[model samples]
Target: MKKNDIIITYGTHISKMVRMVLDKAELALSIPKNARIGIKPNLVVAKTHDSGATTSPLMVEALIQYLQEHGFYDIIILEGSWIGDDTKRAFSISGIEKVAEKYKVPLLDTKDDTYCKIQAGPIEMEISKTALDLDFIITMPVLKGHCQTKITGALKNFKGCLSDKEKRHFHTLGLHRPIAYLNTVLHPGFILMDGLCGDLDFEEGGNPVPMNRIVAGLDPVLIDSYVASAMGYEPDEIDYIKMAAELGVGSMDLEHANLMVLEKDTCPVKTIRSRKVQALAKAVTEKNACSACYANLIQALARLEERGLLSYYKKHPVCIGQTFRDQSGNSLGIGSCTCRFIHSVPGCPPATADILKGLLTGLNTK
Candidate 1:
């Protein structure tokens, strides 16, 4: 596919849909037959693809099958689950291991791989060696909402290729700047987004909203900018996308993007702003907050909202972010940065479920 082209198709048959997009995008023709191809999917958690938190094994298998049929055999699937999660377990739980076995393709857990430092723009970070060794990389990211960045698509998916230390460090650097810089150093040859069903409010995925589509493109910035618009946010609202555009990663101009819809499904789904998310966000007092920490708070608040326990937050607004560090307060706070507060959920970015339980127990005591 050309860098400016974005091919899309819709269906419930996951394998057929993926093949359709790949064929239409001319993805096979764009790569060398002898190239070492790495298929990178978002396995941020140990969850089934239906959970909408990870890429579908059916999609990956289809791509692999298509590649082999096209005379490209040097293929491998690699990924690193988000910090505190196990990639090997994710591969099993997500059914990717079965796909790897079926294709006789080895699965590389980047978490266990060595890394090399790379400089991009004014920033330097370590990336997994396996990722750098690949001649071509196909990134398959789930198009989903993120509490901090607002959305995660093609651009943010590259975070999986970094070392665990670098992944954690990306958050402390505010996520956007480092994500943008990383793209300069590592560019995916192609991007295939899982738009079938994705959680609309959180990245780890529980509340899946089905859209029943697959999107393929060559430009991360262009695809992500379109994703931002589709998810009800301006491209500029997603800091990394805008930054990547400025750093000359790719174009963000959707007006010029060649959008091709091979098969538009009937009753197409469109993203709408969640009233619950709006109400929950009002309860947070954030300043320069990290994505993980903020996302955890949002997930916790969402649980509280569902349980009809969010009323407690009305009186005690939740505080989060770097600005809250070393600051003492009587209010409830959400991360280690806000530890000085009277009530704080500790951890650099505490687990969402833990945050939920902590808020329920701690707020009840207040």
Candidate 2:
């Protein structure tokens, strides 16, 4: 299969799907037996894959089994959870540690590992040593929407390899160009997107939209572009994906890329779930809001509407993001970005439950 070739195998049997893709790609012949392979999965939170916040451990187990069957034993699973979350806890909660133990594959927490400075253009970031040492890298990212970047797929999953300090610094710098630069420098041998159940609008995952399928590809940018189209977005809609394409990481031109299906997909690609997110975001007075903060607010409102407590939300816009700084009025704000507002939900990215309660309290006080 060409680098631009994307293969989609639809089924609940994840291991079978994984093996099928590898066989079709002829991955074993391409790499040496003694090569040090690193399997990177998105484990941003201490949550199960069913929650859509992390990669499926079943998928990892299948990949490990596939490698071991092909005389490849030098495999290690590495990841760092998002700031404020524990990587070890994420591994345990996501059942990745158990998978690692079963396969006798060591697990490395990038959070504790020393980092080396990597610079691409003006973007300088610290990446974990294990990430840099691997002979081959396989990324398993949960396909989902990101509040800041619009989408998180192959390229964005590498953010987990950064040190906690660098992760925060990436936010301080614009996320788009840095993400592009990161992918430009660090290359992944293959990408396996966990699309069985993923959050429609949140990278951290709360409302999972089930679409049982495994998407395997060699090109990260092409995979991300296809995911963009599948999720009701143009490739250009996401700045980072476009930027990555521009930086020569890979092609986003899906029209030219060969998308093959190993079998007929019983589950057709759909975008109806994201429309609800668009509708919910309409009530948000947002400007430069971070992904986690915006996602929290949306999920909180969703919970309220579901529980019939949405009536408690006053008929006014709920403001959020850095653009709301020093802004005043009766507007209910969220996160530290809206600290200037008297009526605000606290935290850099406040908990979804806390956001719901804060909004309810604000309404009652009014």
Candidate 1 stretches greater than 4 Å from native: 267-366
What digit string (tens of lDDT, one per residue) describes model 2 on residues 1-366?
Answer: 688899876666778888888888887876665999999999999999977678999999988998898899999999999998999999999999999999999999999999999887787889998999999998999877787886789999999999999999989887888888999778898888887777876888876655566788889999999777655466898998998998889998988988777853333223324566666666677777655456557656765565565553435778987788778647888887688787888875565556877877876787
The C-alpha TM-scores of every prediction are 0.74, 0.74
TM-score between model 2 and native: 0.74
lDDT of 1 at 308: 86
lDDT of 1 by residue, 126-201 (tens): 9999999999999999988887898899999989998999998999999999999999988899999998777766
Which residue pairs clash within candidate 1? none
Prediction 2 global C-alpha lDDT: 0.80
Runs in model 2 lying further than 4 Å from the true structure: 267-366
Whole-model Cα lDDT per candidate? 0.82, 0.80
Question: Cα deviation in Å at residue 27, candidate 2?
Answer: 1.6
